[model samples]
Target: MESLLLSHSAFIPSQNKEVGYLGRKLQSSFYGNMVSNNFALRSNINSANRSVMISSVFGIGRKVKKVKKETVIPEPDYRIPIVLLGWSGGLIYADNLAAAVPIGLLGLLLLVQTTRVRFVFDDEALEVKVGEQLEESGENVFVGGKNRWKYSSFVNWELWWPNFPILVYFKETQTRPEGQVHFFPVIFNGKQLYDVMVERCGPSKTSAPKES
Candidate 1:
């Protein structure tokens, strides 16, 4: 569950998808609070729009221990969060808002840097842009990487906490199984991305047009 609900959260994307950082921040902020369990998500989309509705958070940034003086991207502020949004699913194509902010002032305090988020859906894989501030502890570093996954490799999924967060785990593969997983959140409106997963996964493969 959310540590505390706040109405005044940062990271709101505009209608044209100009804003960035907020959605990714929200995902990272709520990621740790995730729990492991199985639960079904109800579909809220009607017949008129068969397209799936989801808020994809593409995270960008990596953790650097000691904050070395030399690096890429100049004068980066490890204080503010950055987020960018791109929405897509079936027949639905529109920019969407984010859900509740993670814990409390903690998110504000913890956001040393922000991530970039984008959403991609094709016949091969469901790609959502996701990078991390790269968890750092002055000594070790934890990178926020691997924001893409194949539905075929999808082993199972679980709802994080109270409302929209979801934890999707993948099976052990060539380079995966090193605890490879991604965290995604659903936008408000009584809908869940799990429904999209149920509808999009597996079928997208068979539905692909075959080459002659």
Candidate 2:
């Protein structure tokens, strides 16, 4: 009986140790799985946040607005032609027929051209077109000439006799690779033309006269 009791006590202690070891192993496994799951969840959240930030930044950049410039067209003027015709008449009255006849014809031609030609100043370019309705861009007198010229292509420009502008002259590389010079009688409003030229082409060497 004594021997049997001792054996039973030894068996009880061995079984208890086995049970404790199993419980400790199970607890460690549960904690390790929890820690791994938590780390994975955090990693996923960080990735989503990073994606949202990048998208938002790009979205804000795309939302920026651009302002559009308005087109400016100068009013038609016939002052140059009228002045020429009057001067021709004065010369004829003075009996200077040699110069008067040619000057009178030139004045008449300019008068006709004044009725047809139009200068259009748009946001990006200056366009010379013909007709009362501005429907026709007449054929360029020079070979390889273009009716339209961008302000950016202008090398230099001038309003001759700024106080009483009689001519408009500009040199540009748009028509020819080497360069091209153009001269036009100032048939448009001088003040309007000067303003637009200054605004679009930049400041000129001659300053505009102060307003009275």
Candidate 3:
């Protein structure tokens, strides 16, 4: 589970807003999937009497650490937290609007360096987080258990991002309001996720026709 989530998270393509790119949108999709999964997992944890705690963020420029498992979730700060859960899960954090200014400014100076954000999936849920390593720190979102995304709930998973090896999409639809929402799983277990989707959810109608 750990290996699959980490590989999937690492595989997510980073988008640039400079060229009419959809980085933010893509990021949103990833986050949405994370949330959907986390919600389901958390529900299960509650029912099963197990709990997941997220620590607060710490550390200096370009890096952060979680103080404890139940730490207050990041609020407008790039300071991401480290997630611990009986060795089954991990967490990641991203810059909030308030902290984005400083963090983004610093990010500009480091051009050559690269980091891998780690994400995880357990029996009950999914998570996104940075590791202790300097380059491998970011954000963690949780989804799971009762509230998990069912194959039916997701309308689609699109591959709109270029340059990145993998892209996933999720959608929610309603009759009252005819609209479409897209979600990406920034971090996931590529083969496992793909296999599960294919098995449980199947593919969307609009997906690029599989090359035969």
State the displacement of the C-alpha of residue 185, model 1, in Å, after optimal TM-score superposition: 5.2
RMSD of each: 42.1, 4.3, 43.2
The full ranking of all candidates by TM-score, starting with the best, is 2, 1, 3
TM-score of each: 0.29, 0.72, 0.28
List the global CA lDDT of all models.
0.35, 0.82, 0.40
Cα TM-score of candidate 2: 0.72
Stronger candidate by lDDT (2 vs 3): 2
lDDT measured at residue 113 in model 2 versus the true structure, 0 to 100: 82
Choose 1 or 2, whichever is better by lDDT.
2
Stretches of candidate 2 exceeding 4 Å from the true structure: 1-60, 63-66, 205-212
lDDT of 1 by residue, 119-201 (tens): 34445555543334422223112334354456567655443332423223333132255545444332211123334454445
| Model 2: residue 87 alpha-carbon error in angstroms | 1.4
Give the Å error, residue 132, model 3.
Answer: 15
Q: Pick the candidate with the highest lDDT.
A: 2
